[model samples]
Target chain A: MVLSQKLHEAFKGTVERITSHRTVSAFKEKGVLSVTEFIIAGDNLVSKCPTWSWESGEPSKRKPYLPAEKQFLITRNVPCLRRAASVEEEYEAAGGEVLLDNEDNDGWLATHGKPRETKEDEEDNLPSMDSLEIGKKNSIQSIPSYFGGEEDEDIPDMAEYEEPDNLIETDPATLQSTYLVAHEPDDDNILRTRTYDVSITYDKYYQTPRVWLTGYDESRMLLRPELVLEDVSQDHARKTVTIEDHPHLPGKHASVHPCRHGAVMKKIIDVLMSRGVEPEVDKYLFLFLKFVASVIPTIEYDYTMDFDLGSSSR
Target chain B: MADASEKKPILQFAPFQSVVDEGFWHRLSSLKLNKLGIDDSPVPISGFYAPCSHAQVSNHLTLLSESLPTEASEQAACTSSVSLGNRNKCSVPGTIYNTNTLEGYHALDKQSLLKAEAKKIWDDIHSGKALEDSAALSRFLIISFADLKKWNFYYWFAFPALVLEPAATLVGIKPASQWLSPEEAEYLSAACREWRNSNLTADVPFFLVSIASDSSATIRHLKDWEACKGNGHKLLFGFYDPCHLPHNPGWPLRNYLTLIFIKWNIRRIHFLCYRENRGFADMGLSLVGEALISVPEVWKDLNSVPNAVGWEYNMGKKGSKCVNLAKAMDPTKLAIAAA
Candidate 1:
């Protein structure tokens, strides 16, 4: 298994090098970014999405090629209310419609299968209908229902799991009779879901914008690396997500392996172009976030915005 | 009142889990090497947390690049008072005692250090300074030894929580959505959203919430409690709760509870555990809990500091967490690994 994994890494590395070689200076064609282009795109993202801001990382660790402040783009405390597995289950249960069949060898968009029933409801409620992108409506609709349905049941069970210190002093009889049976029908309970501080840094190796996630548990404790994996979509969990040292930030963070990011971005851009939307290099992060959403669907980071994609078809 | 028939659970708080960023240690290493070669003094550092933003996850007091002093020459200034518009980063004032040697770190009087830290919080609570900035109630301490040669950092964080004598009892606890009427929840959510979005109040970790008979809610600073009490319809002590557990609130509430009981002479209080989802006030994730407290006789003197118990647990023990970042941070290893 280890040998196969090593082979896979080697193959991925070779593929990335070859693809990067082909699209040396091309952002639209190759879907990879130069360090300069990354800074421009980061600036554009920050201006568009106020939540995303440029951060100057450790002074000594700063890449000489990148500007001091533009070492990374960070948006902290992004909530992930549900596991991606739950989204997959719900989508399957709803008889999810495949928006686009995977034509490109990089079939990342195949995971874009979403239930269409909630689209009209979202379209009615959202005032900025023009800003609504094609695939965003479905996943956005899942958030509220996910909160309402799952949150109620999770609380009473959690109530039973209090600090042992609180329980020890109490009489054994009272503990048995009062607390264990006192599972009052807690319908109105807080959804204690995982939170993530998501960041993006330019990867010189793959020539792609790499995404990193630092997740915290309900009690603000750092989630174990394995626990962090539960939030990642099953498709990319083991294959694409790896715990590595964050380029700018301190400590190891779960990063979406950037080896196939360029290929995936290329496929996404082509799909957009076919739909009469001209993708801009500056708007790359937006597209990057949209695709990253498939890998980490439940992390409710602000990625969708009212950027004009120059869609003549619309 | 340990009446077996009517025994209710005593209110307990979940201890804080510290997350020291890689940059924090890296910066500390630089400081140790360049600025203070052998000086072992308590350095004031800033720790950042937001209102619990996720349903299950509590917001950790995260040490970032901005947590440490930037300049080697200048004394580290407390940046907790300066409100950065980012609602996600509410700075809490903290002190870090970095020792020269591992033996020195172990030799340091931990009990007295914790007492000293807790006394600062106690002083702030009594002097009405904590009312101005309740972030003072969440004062934290760190004792660390940076092994610069090995790039190993042995550190432990203590978020000093003043123990309430005759500990607070949980009258009732439930989700804010269930506790408040739809209209009341709506008004409270709107008020909280406004508070979180504002540049000034966004970083204020603690505040007072007054709900009118008409279900109109207003969020005020802790200092405005006197003003709020006069016009109060229904008052709830609101704080940026960092715990999402259904049973208990986070560690910050322990000191806040002490402050409310001792300072305000409040025996009973309805607290709003202000949590958020997607940057908006999430009433479902937020909690409303009623706690009853009796002021300890010792607190009447106002001179004696209460015994605190908030040394952060590492792997379920009262121990320091060590991080070896040599492979990740060393330039030679990085270059070799990259190749």
Candidate 2:
């Protein structure tokens, strides 16, 4: 609908009121046009202008980019607490093989028996004992008796009897081949597609941006709220989380509370303020969405990707 | 200049505008002061701190006293007496007048008092009581000032109100009181004209979709419209009664809608509602059209007629009559008029 002059004036008035003087000045000092000015000048004009420079320096020059380590601490899988008895039982159940170093190391086996010429030849010569029964026996024998004696020598050679060569070789060529096989364009791998369709709509009730994440499960089915919960960080999921019916979609969806969005935006504004720049209110949302996109890379949000700081326009 | 009684001299400094070059002050003095029959004296280049209006000062004091803790209030009261004495010494309403000397006239004391009061009020509001009392919450919103040169000041003002407050209540309070200056308004209008020109010549086609209520039938109708028109061109949707949606919070609808339009780079809008719903039309028009003018042009070209389409639905007949809002807006045709 075409805006009446009066209504137009009111909106303009609100924009003017909300525009930050500090953000604008900061933009000017950096020799870049304000977001509002960039918008008003049209994309063509803005594209022609010099790009905005960050006060800390160019992103590339700010700090050296460290490649992510291939093997880092997997905190999610680490158990915070464990019972001593149960842990001891688990260790014993593995036939004292649990404490063995990297599978490549042969020290643990050296104490048990001499290395065989080949795994197949060793397996052919070993007796086939009932694994479960042996495990049960090992657990019982693992506990030290109160009336101590030479129990260590009496313990059965469970490790030598069990299957040898259980550890797979980790040569670089084999590792690379395994990686290639996992990522190969197979039907099973194709079926396990990971995609998150993100749409940003306003919650009239909250007056804040409502981000909707419609993710596809491994089987390509629409994910339920409970399943989606698994994708969110545990700390975030624990906070005032709710599963509301989607306004436009078919079923119940998880709506993340945008409690942190404003603070994050404020931090960006603070950065701009420190640099003596005043950004327009309209520009805050745009910059904010981009900042958040880095946190949740799988979800494809609108406008966040289109913004080009280098070109000074979308 | 004659007839000194007709014109009152403006001795108060405008710190926000004070940073303007000497030429600007000279031109302002020549054009404005000369006509008022007052001395065309140049505004001082320096020594002026931030200026606070009387309403702001009084509001700050009231907020400080009511919201501050008892100990803080007691401390403030002790300080208030000293500030009060200083204020009384210079009783002039807008300008600070000094009895000691002619050049000593300055509002520095009052300005400092206002700043201290503002700080205390900010601390108290953020201390947790603002969430309980609607008045305190609204006061927090009022603190988001446009005239402040320091961007950090506005950032601090907006942060708590925007983040901490419940979304249900935050939408009800309007956040800002300042209006666009004449220069800003003119620039915005010119930008709108440029945007319109650029869009008119672009290769892309634009569609204006109208939404009235949030019913299954309404959704079906929108789907049909999209199916019919969303083939080659981009479809831009606008609502007439967005508040009618079951979950709508009512406030922030305009800004949010405008944001969506800009984000999607929508070209035109159709504000659809019953014949009497002027409120919905006004909101739709303000957000979809006026708000976009200040920003970049989203419309490809201006060849399309009636950039703003207003639809009035007839409840009894289950049909809507569309009008070209580019021609004229008739409030009598709004849905509210039928009632």
Q: Give the candidate number with the greatest TM-score.
A: 1
Question: Model 1 over residues B1-339: C-alpha lDDT tens digits?
Answer: 333236566787766777766668777887788888899999999898877655645567888767888764433333323336667678899999999997798777777888899999999988999999889999999999887765667777888877766667788889999999999999999998788768788789999999999999999999887778867489999999877666667778888988888787888788988887655688998889998776657686678888777777643445665555565556775565455
In model 2, where do residues sit more than 4 Å from their true spots? A1-190, A218-220, A238-241, A247-250, A302-314, B1-339
Residue-level lDDT of model 2, residues A88-159, one tens digit each, is 344444543333333437766654433432443443333222323432333232222111124223222222
Compose the digit string of candidate 2's lDDT tens values, residues B1-339: 223233322111000000111112222222332342333222111111110111101001111111111222233333232212111011111111111211121212322333333343244333433222212211211111111111000101110111111111111111011122334333333432232224231101112332222211111122244353544432223222112211121111222233233334432332221100110112211222212122334222223111110111111111111111110112342223222
RMSD of each: 12.2, 33.1
Candidate that would win on DockQ: 1
Candidate 2 lDDT score at position A2: 25
DockQ of 2: 0.00
lDDT, residue B120, model 2: 32
